[model samples]
Target: MDDLRRIDLNLLLTLHALLAEQHVTRAARRLHKSQPAISHALAQLREIFKDPLLTRRGAAMALTPRAQDLQRPLEAALNQLTSLLREGAFDPHQAIRHFRVAMSDYAAHLVLPTLVKRLRDQAPGIDIAVCQASREAMLAQLGDGEIDMALGVFPDTPSNIWVETLFQEHFISVADKRSLPLRGKLSLAQWLARPHVLVATRPDADNEIDSALAAQGLHRHIALVLPHWSASTKVLTDTDLILTVASRTLDPVLHGQELMQFTPPFKLPRFPFQQAWHIRRDSDPAHHWFRSTVMDCSRTSPQSGEKQAVSR
Candidate 1:
């Protein structure tokens, strides 16, 4: 008996539309259900709660006190449920969709241009909004459903977010051609001694170079800090101002200019850069397309030198 009564969930949805509109005809249109169906649902709700859910004043029907109490929360719950059902199975090729992706300025330096091209080629009508930020806030926004995806080296975040490895890259340094004092390659020592710019601004960072420097019991001096890798790269004019970056992404941005690549002075662990999205969107077709597309772009990015093999 309880199961039977509990299973008629449609009544709740109908009740939601009825209490909100306060008119049988309007609620029917809103629910795509007939006026008689709404009237029947109102009766069922009255029986369930033992209260008239709505009352009439002239032609306008006002919600009863009980209905008013239940209105907003009920509407919010229904809206969330509807959003859940409608979230997935979005087709990229035909659907006009815009998705927001969060990434660091450094991460964007390696992947966005190619990702954009792929999106345009595969789904012309689709659009992307790239938001660059630190990993923590991005992950929080992802959990709260404010952000759709986050890109970069988010190696060990929580389990609720899905991380797809985009690439594992060998970090290196780049400098302009006219700027090179001497060189086919600069040694790790020379790399470390030069004025280097780090793309980290946050107070605490799991910085890749710190690990690299720690390995050799040495550290690079930070001459400047930029919010994005693009700015750092462009700032590496002809001077000896060296830019620490992933080797895989260096060549693409280096237009055969006087730029150079060198191994780091110390043995630092390479970072695995991945794309993350909330688990809720795991089955979403458009999100699936975006994930695969990012992986494809990262893997075939000739600019990154070696293709990063994706792992889950």
Candidate 2:
């Protein structure tokens, strides 16, 4: 530490230029400094390192053995310092960065398609890795920096985390047309009578649908409970099981499927589908761009009664 304090960093840059150019005049030109200034800097570098870093060999200047040893390491150190100083500038188009995100298949269905398409066209070198975890695990992973961000409904976020609503989504009840043959609006009695497929991230999760049903002193039978919403539409194709999921979850998977989507019999309040990250990443330029892109993509498929994006 004392040695580092004694050495001038600016002189090191001069030393690097001198070592590269191997001539005082050329080194000065490279650094846009006068020849005498570079020579003075070289003299100071020699005194600090206790070695003649550059020596005149015949008609041109050459590097000493010590200078040759310092060349690669000094260049690497300066490159790292340059990157550290420019950390605020994130060029998405040229950056080859990998981001890990935690989200449910439902959020993936809503955001991934447009996100991937945009990434392919705008930032070809960037990659996104998506993972699924329970809400508790997602929070923990965000805190531990295991994932860059998470997308879902985060109702009880911690003080150390930040939440931004990508969009507001409401429930859309779907059923196999061949089996239930339902249309626009499902009756409460008919909805309660059919077996349902419940998509819950955690086994003990009490979803809004169940809460709405419990409020009316009625409960539907859940014949199957799955963790992923990707296959939820396909699961209802040949069965009598009906599912009430976020409208966006069914958007991509409902094409050419024998399914009927209708309004839920009971009113389920629209929830904010959100993206969360550690508060530490709140001001990161790249993360800001990413979350903004996500919000924009989410707006592409706006829900009827949904609210606009809200950042908190």
Candidate 3:
């Protein structure tokens, strides 16, 4: 208890950096402190814990058994303390933060360009890393802190996640204007008969579009299964293959291409595009700022007039 009284909060931060980096030089670099200061802290830490927390192995430093035992609990405690300290307010302009966002290629195409531009203007010091992943992978990434937020449709949300609907979009059939006799529309039979390009990030999981068709005892001829939304454009442009994509996703991809958008004859459920985050970050100021910024960007994005009719 007396040792606890002698401890400074900064020592825990140094210990965290040291344990994470496993080298005094690296820890000092991470803490933005002089190497001697880090060594001094390590010395103090050794005195407090009555153990050489780190021991040199050849040229590298390694955590001792006692230090290894403290790693996880120390990291978790530090994270909790950091979160508590950050609850007051967020200043976007001055804060330097790295935000990791998991999004589909389609969402990145439609949303990230504008979101990045807005973030650059509003929060110059903040950096964003966009990762492409399936919804399941994204949820796992969120839980593990690999991603800060996820942007896409999540039909069934778990209770532990927090979701905010950004916008609603619906599917539109896109085909080469010249290759197919598509005059802005296709019948149910025509739509089903055409060879389609399906975008499925995970091949094993059934896409919502396919599931909806299966419910109605109908299925389209999916001649090509691509992992990305952008890949469908080349197939649609070069062949008679039709691709059904979200209206917002289609709008951006169709630019400079001969693709023509038409409403599907069969009714499909509208996509509720949302931003999801772990419930742990629901009240974090930086995360709140990020979510708010994304929401603002999604709301102000220019709508495609052609797809306006399909949006509900």
> Which ranges of candidate 1 are over 4 A from the true structure?
1-90, 106-110, 176-189, 201-204, 251-255, 301-312
Query: TM-score of every model?
Result: 0.62, 0.65, 0.67
Which portions of model 2 miss their true places by more than 4 Å?
1-88, 181-185, 251-257, 301-312
Q: Give the per-residue Cα lDDT of candidate 3 at 58.
A: 98
Model 1 reaches what TM-score against the true structure?
0.62
Q: What is the C-alpha lDDT of each candidate?
A: 0.71, 0.79, 0.78
**RMSD over all Cα atoms, model 3:** 9.8
Give model 2 RMSD, 1 decimal. Answer: 16.1
lDDT of 2 at 172: 85
* Model 3, span 36-84: residue lDDT tens: 9999999999998999999989987878989978876785687678768
lDDT of 1 by residue, 119-166 (tens): 787788888888877778887787666778888777557544667667
lDDT of model number 1: 0.71
lDDT tens string, model 2, 151-186?
888777754567877777788888877765434456
Q: Rank the candidates by lDDT, best first.
A: 2, 3, 1
